[model samples]
Target: MRIFPARLPDCLILQPQRYQDNRGFFQETFRAADYAKAGISEPLVQDNWSRSVKGVLRGMHFQRLAPQGKMVSVLRGEIYDVAVDIRPGSASFGQWQGLVLSEHNGHQLWLPPGFAHGFLVLSDVADVIYKTSAYYQADDEGSFCCFSAALNIDWPVTDVIRSAKDAGAPDFSTVFP
Candidate 1:
């Protein structure tokens, strides 16, 4: 696996080496030692999966009490994945990075505990799976509006379909202050 540091140094884009044959392709998504060597020291405790249609947007969400470090990848189709630096005191606070993730590329994004994560579907349908360092805590979760003016993320699609929770999420300023 090759781990590349993202624009926010703590975030990582992990690419697994694939071996292909006439039958199919094989790749190792996670190996404890390999991940530890790449500086991803957290032990993943939960796995979550979601499917969305084109124009669907989810997140810009994170937990404050049990912050989760997540390793996210696309299982089918494609998406524009985003991670925003929200850690207080970090030099890049309020900044974000976006990447194209698709089944064909087999790339994964490792978002450490201090960032908010989200994605927008770019295909007819997309399936996303993620491994999280922490368990889900409903009372601990929080979200900033995906299209908050303060963050001003340049999401690929304009006509987004969002859940009631996400649509009514607080803005970045409200989240931080």
Candidate 2:
């Protein structure tokens, strides 16, 4: 796997080495040794998957007390995925990076703790899967409005379907403070 750094300090774009044949293809999505060699030592505690239709947006979410470090990928279709740096005292604080992920490319992103994660479905439907370093804690969960002016994210989709909680998330101006 090739690990490439994104604009954010700890965020990474992971490109797997795919072995393809007429029959199919195989790749090691996650290998401890490879990750450890790259200086990533986060311990994954949970895996989650979600399916969303085109124009659906989810997140900008994180857990303040138990921030999650996520290894994210798409199982089907495609999306515009983004991660924002929210770590206090970090030089990249409030900065964000985006990438286009699809089943065809077989690429993924690793977003370390102290970042907010979100995605916009770009195909007819998209299946997103991820492993998290921490377990979900309801009380610790928090989100910033995906369209908050302060965030200034350039979402590719004009029409978006969002969860009630996500739609009502505090704006970055309020949430970041």
Candidate 3:
């Protein structure tokens, strides 16, 4: 597997080696030793999955108390995934990065703790699976509006569909300031 750093450096894109034959293909999604060698030593403690339809947007979300470090991949269809640097004292604080992830690419993204993550479905439907370093904590959850003017995410679509919770999230300035 080859790991490429995203624009933020700490965020990474992992491209797994695929072995193909007449039948189909196989790839090792994760290997503990290899991951540790790559500097990702977090012990993934939880896994979560979600399915969304075209135009659906989720997140700009993060956990404050027990922040999660996630390894996210698309199992079916495609999405424009995004991560924002929310670490209080980091050099890239408040900055964001985006990437196109799909089943065909066999690529996965890693967003370490101190980042907010979200995605917009680009295909008719998308199934996303993610491994997290921490378990979910409802009371510790936090989010910023996807369209927050301060963050200025250049989302590909204008007709976004979002949950009431996401739509009601505070702006970036309100969250950080």
The residue-level lDDT of candidate 1 at 8 comes to: 90
lDDT of 3 by residue, 10-106 (tens): 8889998989999988888778787787789789999899999999999989999899999999999999999999999999999999999999998
Instruction: Count clashing pairs, candidate 3.
Output: 0
- Cα TM-score of candidate 1: 0.97
Candidate 2 vs candidate 3: which has greater TM-score?
A: 3
**Candidate number with greatest TM-score:** 3
Candidate 1 residue pairs in clash (backbone atoms < 3 Å): none
Off by over 4 Å in 2: none
Q: How does each model score on lDDT? A: 0.93, 0.90, 0.93
Give me the displacement of residue 125 in model 1, in angstroms: 1.1
Per-residue error (Å), model 3, residue 92: 0.3
- The order of the candidates by TM-score, greatest first, is 3, 1, 2
Model 1 Cα RMSD, 1 decimal: 1.0
User: Compared with the true structure, what per-residue lDDT tens digits does model 2 show for residues 19-46?
Assistant: 9999998988878788777777999889
Residue runs of model 1 more than 4 Å from their true location after superposition: none
Per-residue lDDT of 1-177 in model 1, one digit per residue for the tens? 988889996999999888989998898877888889999999999999999999999998999988999999998999999999988899999999999999989999999998999999999999999999999999999999999899899999879999999999999989897
Alpha-carbon deviation at 56 in model 1, angstroms: 0.8
